[model samples]
Each structure stands twice: as C-alpha cells, then as structure tokens.
Target: MNHEHKISNWDLIKNGLFGENTIFRMAISLCPAIAVTTSLKNGFLMGAAVLFVQTMVNITVSLLRNFINPRIRIPVFMLIISGWVSVTDMTMAAFAREAYRQMGLYIQLIVAFASILARAEMFANKNKVVPSMFDGIGMGLGFMFALVVISFFRELLGRGTIWGYEIVATKPLLIMLLPTGGFFAVGILMAFFNWIDIRFYGGKGAGGAGGH
Candidate 1:
C-alpha cells in the first residue's frame, strides 16, 4: 500500500496497531517479544524502551533520508538506530536503574529489530517527518500492546499474578512462563488476531513473517 499518497494519518496509526501489528500480524521481532514477555514488568519495560528508540530512529531516518546515499542507506539506518538505542540504554541506566537492570539487554537488542528497521526503510525514508513520527508511534504502541497482551496471559497463567501481584490462588499453567510457552502464546494470539481480521475487517489474513 502507498501509505504516503493514499492513507490518512489516523489510518496509519491504526494500520500499525492492528493491520500491521509487529507480533500478531507482521510477526517480526518475535525473539524479543517472546523473550521479555514472561513477566509483565519485563514486557512493559522493554516495550517502553523500544517505543522511545523506534520513534527517535524514525524521526532521525526521515530527517536524513535525502542526504543518505542509496548504497549506504542500510548502514546509515543501523547507525541511526544504534545511536537511539544507546541513548535509551544510558538514559535508563542513569534514571531507571532497577528497570535497566532487568531490561538492559533487550534495550540494546532494539537496534536489531526488523520491524523498527523496516519502518525506517519502508515508511520513514519515503514519508514526510510528521507522518513518519506518527507511524513510529503507531508501530511502537502496537508492539507494546502485543507485549502487554502476551505477558499478561503468560504471567497470569504461569504465576497467577499480574506484575508480581497475586491474582489466582494457584498457578493456572506453570509451563506458560517457559520459552515453549512463549511460542504457544504467540501462535495462539497470532491465530486469534488473524481470525479477527478475517471475520471483522474482511482481511485476507496475516501474511508471511519475512515480508513487510
């Protein structure tokens, strides 16, 4: 879709949140999504870090799009992404020490996220600054939303708690906190979202994970 020419700003936001969600729809960056989502606290912290890096990277990429050489654009994008990721890393280290201790690795991992890099190449590089900023917000929020949903179920089912607060008297499914459980959660949620798309939005369904 030619989002720059045809789609409205609000639609771009919705598109990222639902139509092209990072987890349930796009399926990119599943590694971090699954890894950090075993706990609600980790999931939220990682999502927040990603949100900051993604928005800043998009804004930086959009501003530098014209000046970047086509042959070196990929490297330039990585530089921009890493720069933002480092900023987040140091900022959190100084301010949010406890959270940084929990999520420092994932924050650094944001530099390699396919979804963030894809937006820089596909959307931000071609779109104007304002739209790119909103697109970043949308994509970041979509990712954060996915992490929250997955972590919500995982934590509640596995530990019977939400953010370390007790909910159920007993663990509903202990395996839900394991890595294998992450796969199950992602798969089930992916299907659920695809069903929603087909049933309500008349969508063909979720596309392959590799494509944008």
Candidate 2:
C-alpha cells in the first residue's frame, strides 16, 4: 500500500500538532523559539510567518519535485525556501512594521529553517501535493503551537503581562525574558510533555515522534 494513500490528511496534521512538533519534539529551530519568544505577540507572529512560508514551500516543492534533478535538489530546495521566506518577509514588513522591526532578521532567517527544509527533503519531495501541503500545515502549526506556549509563559512570568496588558502589579521575573529563561522554560515544558507522552501516549520521547 502507498503511504500517501494509507494516511489521511487529518492524521498528517495531527502528527505535526502533537506527535512530532518541530520545536517540542524534533528540537529543531530553537533559535527563534528562544530569540523571538520573549513576548506572546512576537512569538505568535513569528510562528504565523513560518507557518505560511512552510506551507507554501512544501506545496511548491512537491509540485516541482519530479522536475527537480536529484543532484541539484538541495540548492533548488534552498531557492524555494528562500523565495517563500522573502514573500513572507515582505508581507510582514508591510503589514506589521513594528513586529518586522523587532524580529525581521529572524524572519529572513526562516529561509534556513530546518523544519521547512527537512520537510521538503523528507516528506514533501516524496509525497503528493495535497499530502505534502497537509504535512506542511501540521508541522507549521506544531511549530507555532510550541512558540505560543513558550512565549505565553515567558511573557506572563517575566513581564507579568500578556499581549502587553499588565496582569500582575508586582516585580516581574526578569530572567524569564532572557535567553537563560527561554532554555529553562523549554526544558520544563519539554519534560512535562515527555511525561505526558510516556504516561498516556506510550511514546518514547523524540525517537517515536512522527517527523520521520
């Protein structure tokens, strides 16, 4: 049986949402997770941008897969990824200027995102266009989901605020806004999710994840 035929689109999406989330499970693309996730808004916007780029890249690559020569696939993939990232970069710059100013470079850096390129090479290149698109959506959503969770805690705990609205009138935990705090937050969350996987999902940490 063909893999694509056996797998439903929703299963493909669910796989990315929980089974093999890029940041939480695959552990790739931590730079943005740490660098841009100090605030919920930044994190969510970053995730949204990546989601769009990843989806477009996957669909484009899958559509062009047969035409791409095997020997030149890597460079071709980079070109595709970069093209989509540039589109995303320009769109964000035009619509969300302040956010673009804050994490603009990071958005450009999405051209080099492992999750996007990895999906292009691993799943998208081998799959049909619709399946590849869903895979991209799932993985992108997973990445966004991870960033949202990470940023939510970092902002709430560090700034005593959510989305720039002050909730607590006390001194915030300054460390949570720093890179050190990012690591701590990711570790604790990773461990918590790992516990959930082991206890109920019967997962073996990252090894049994759905990315592969």
Best by TM-score: 2
On the 0 to 100 scale, the lDDT of residue 176 in model 1 is: 93
Measured by lDDT, the strongest candidate is: 2
lDDT string, candidate 2, 110-187, tens digits = 988888999999988999999999999999999999999999999999999999999897647989999999999998
Candidate 1 C-alpha lDDT tens digits along 165-207: 9999999999998999999999999999878777887777786
lDDT against the true structure, each candidate: 0.88, 0.91
**Off by more than 4 A, model 2:** 210-212
lDDT of 1: 0.88
Worst 10 residues of 1 by lDDT: 203-212
Clashing pairs in 1: none
Q: What is the TM-score of each predicted model, taking all chains together?
A: 0.94, 0.96
Candidate 1 residue-wise lDDT at 162? 97
